[model samples]
Target: MRFKSIVLVSHVTDLSGPSEAVENYLKTRSDRLGVIYHPFHYCADRRSRMQDYRGGTLLREARQGGWNLPALATYVKDALFTLFYFLRLGGRYDVYLGADPLNTVVGVVLKWLGLTNFVIFYTIDWMPERFSNKLLNAVYHWLDRFCVRHCDAAWNISPRIQDVRRSQGLPDAKNVLVPVGVDLEKIDLPDKSASEPRDLVLLGALAPSKGVDLVIDAFPRLKERFPQLRLHVIGKTPHDAVEDGVVYQPYEPRLAALGEGVILHGAKPHDEVLAMLPAYDVALALYKPSPNNLSQWADPSRVKDYLACGLPTIITPVPEIHKDIAALNAGIVVDYAVEPLADAIGRMLADPGQWRSMREAALAYMRSYSWSSILDRVFEESFRAKA
Candidate 1:
């Protein structure tokens, strides 16, 4: 009783795992999948977008209300638009997978209205304090718990999220840990010798929480120890000091001030990031430690990308994926500090053999986390349970 058709009511934020999963399904079985995506813009220059896809083809793509829509207004609009869209389709989907609590609530309502057979609440990120506004934060949790209790199942990106859900007293709800996966098929790394100077790469938003600042701070000491080392950052920084409710100082100027050896290639396409990751020897995911940091509950896509590209990663303990990397001997897990980060990179630089071994382990570990395999397993088990 495999589910033949699926739909996702998701917010298109970045090229994260959920996006990759959608791509995987669309590529193979487009006729069996549909998506309603809303672009989460960080700047007013870009307008709000809504895209609809079915059978690997774009059904409709629209931009309206510019970027001035309030958060609550946006959610209401999304829900109403999705309800009408699903109604127009006559609700033939076997499964409805939503990317967040708001999106999942839409799916739950669809099920109540007899539009979809099963609803999957995909929990990508969860923080103790999700919203800065007290009222919004409370509402967010209420919606989150409501979705968890009402949806058929909850798909969490990390085990820690499942633990958090339990602590929130939703332990009885069906929970599945669907960790971030890598696209191994598109990876074509240059077959370079291990003796080549091992350069470092960090692939994510250039925000302080991503440990971009820590990497930059550690760069000088690391350079002093290993003169040939380079740090390649491949992502965009916020235009202002604040955007998307997260206040972060833009690192573009600081990165530019680093002169040479520190390359700041702002926001490359996802395919390009995959192509570029293999050129580096070590990956940095030094996420800052904070109780409110959502990365702590997420299986970061960047870490999976690094592993897939066969680059040994150096990450902090904030993400649960770090424990897996540390246990598998695929990467070093250091504290989120300048000195520890520098020391770890220095250690990796001094031992090329160990570095090579870790790289091999990384590649080996990523085989089990390929998109094709992960998606296949997820749908199979999910559909079986529904049957």
Candidate 2:
């Protein structure tokens, strides 16, 4: 009812994370809902790429970015080529949405060319500090400012990110709080709970930023309290760069010393993880505070997933969900240290009554973070651009 269609642009090669969320939302709306959709992304293989999206197109120059300088060149080419692709579309879509700066640049240029009525730049996980050099960080900072200045609206995943934009001299009115929300169907809680549960799960990539080592280090104390508390690292290994970190350098060997309590289940399918979550008593998303965390840029999904499975969560300050975890009695949000983490989990497990109450609260809180509630606001704002 708002716009003719919405075009989402991202340079990400995978449709697994955020892209998968978008696709799930698309399935709910009908062709007559006037919610026609389009997606723009990178694909190294044209034949295999864009197969998931009916209206999506491949960025011909798009190659996965690497640590080398060619990665920088490949990104620049992707952004420049996206501009050409936009023009080639003859402005078919009414609203333009982009995930990162380069994609935002393409949307901004589309708006300038009168190809779209509104330019919505969705700021998800951003980490200028993750860059290897100062020059690249500085360049990304400038590009971020450019997007903030040019876009008609900002769809930010975290409220904290708005402060980052305002510091760049943008107004609060320009930024809309749009959480990277969860799909209700996919994240449904299993009917039955763990009968005699004493397991904890830390989901997501095993990265330095993710604080996998912090969890491991904190576990010696957690294990002392709950001897039956098995910790599951349920995700893939960190990026190649981070795998070389002191903590992750041959993580298996380092993890082996932690003993039989810790289980490293590398990267499971989405459905399997959801189903497996209720088997654990506590879910962990304890990211160590860093310039590279999703805390400021996006709402971390692991927390949402854990809650949807009706498991109380243990998290650090690095996730945007910490406040909710604290306020709603959902779970523990403790300092990123060994003693504090151990104390929190110890307190949580010591009281079976409190843990049961928090488990219920976790599901209730997760209801608010569903995508069904957020997508309407996203489209409502996009449609209002002309008004």
Candidate 3:
């Protein structure tokens, strides 16, 4: 039987990945689906917001910082607000998909209360130590395991998460791989013979674990070899010094030192990022090695976007997608180091024939990851009748 009515709950920091994909897909069924989003704004000037959508239309959207509290407090407040908002809507839905653990736990509670039929725990990122605080970290994992064992199904963004879960001996949650997908319809392939000094791009937040510093350190040597080569670093950096499993630092000065060789375009809209990917010859996803690095358990959406736009990527073996990319010859997988990353970029730029061939492979591989097809498979597997 097909699910007639659904609602998706997710925390929004940016317009990216699985959340955006799922929301867009559900909107097509606007007659029956709903969406609840809690957007967290880092800048004090930008207030937190809550958005509610139903029957394919936005029912309410509110923005205010009346309760401008600390990060932990904000999160707790958001969870309560989500519960109240669903209750306000009569609290009934056929399917409820929540992105992060906290959001999914809310759904599980609603299910326990007989307000929702099927609850999906959509695992986006899993780090060994999710929070720096010992008590909070323990609480986070307890909630995660609780959701997995209790939810109707656990939708892991990567297969590795399933493996990780089993290793932890968590009770069998009906696990499904709902990997990150690309918007194929919007992305046009870059011109194969576009002459260069070709450029490289790295998308998403410029975090320490994201390997932005490694990229910066390697840029000078790369620029010396190919005088006209440019590196486009997209997305924002930490607004303040904070610790949440990973340390945050200000890297604006370091980026500024590179001048014309490195172009920093901070946090563009997701659609704009898609539009800009095709112009670059190579994409970078060099995640640094750390036991707590979240990328290790993620199926990164940026890599998918790069492949969809027909740009061969230079990635570290941190994400689950890297294995497929390496196997398909769609991209180069290197250690999370400056030299390997720089060399990988050089190889892609110096050899026109190899880059073109890899670009073809990337496009071919990405066809399987279109949002429509991926979500269709997810629902089919999720809601399939058992005899």
Q: Tens-digit lDDT track for model 1 on 221-313?
A: 777777788888888774434634658767888887876788888777688888888888999888888877888878888889999998899
Model 1: ten consecutive residues of lowest lDDT:
43-52
lDDT of 2 by residue, 242-335 (tens): 4222444645556668897988886676767876777778887777776655464678777788887888888887767788888999998887
Task: Please give the TM-score that candidate 3 achieves against the real structure.
Answer: 0.91
Q: Which residue runs of candidate 2 sit more than 4 Å off their true CA positions? A: 1-3, 11-16, 27-69, 80-91, 126-132, 167-173, 191-196, 220-225, 243-248, 256-261, 292-294
Q: Write the per-residue lDDT of candidate 3 for residues 312-360, one digit (tens) a residue.
A: 8888887778888899999899998888888888888788888888988
Instruction: Choose 1 or 3, whichever is better by lDDT.
Output: 3
Model 3: pairs clashing at backbone N, Cα or C within 3 Å: 30-55
Highest lDDT, which number? 3
By summed lDDT, the worst window of 10 consecutive residues in model 3 runs over: 41-50
Candidate with the greatest TM-score versus the true structure: 3
lDDT of each: 0.76, 0.66, 0.78
What is the TM-score (0 to 1) of candidate 2? 0.81
The order of the candidates by lDDT, greatest first, is 3, 1, 2
Candidate 1 vs candidate 2: the TM-score winner is 1
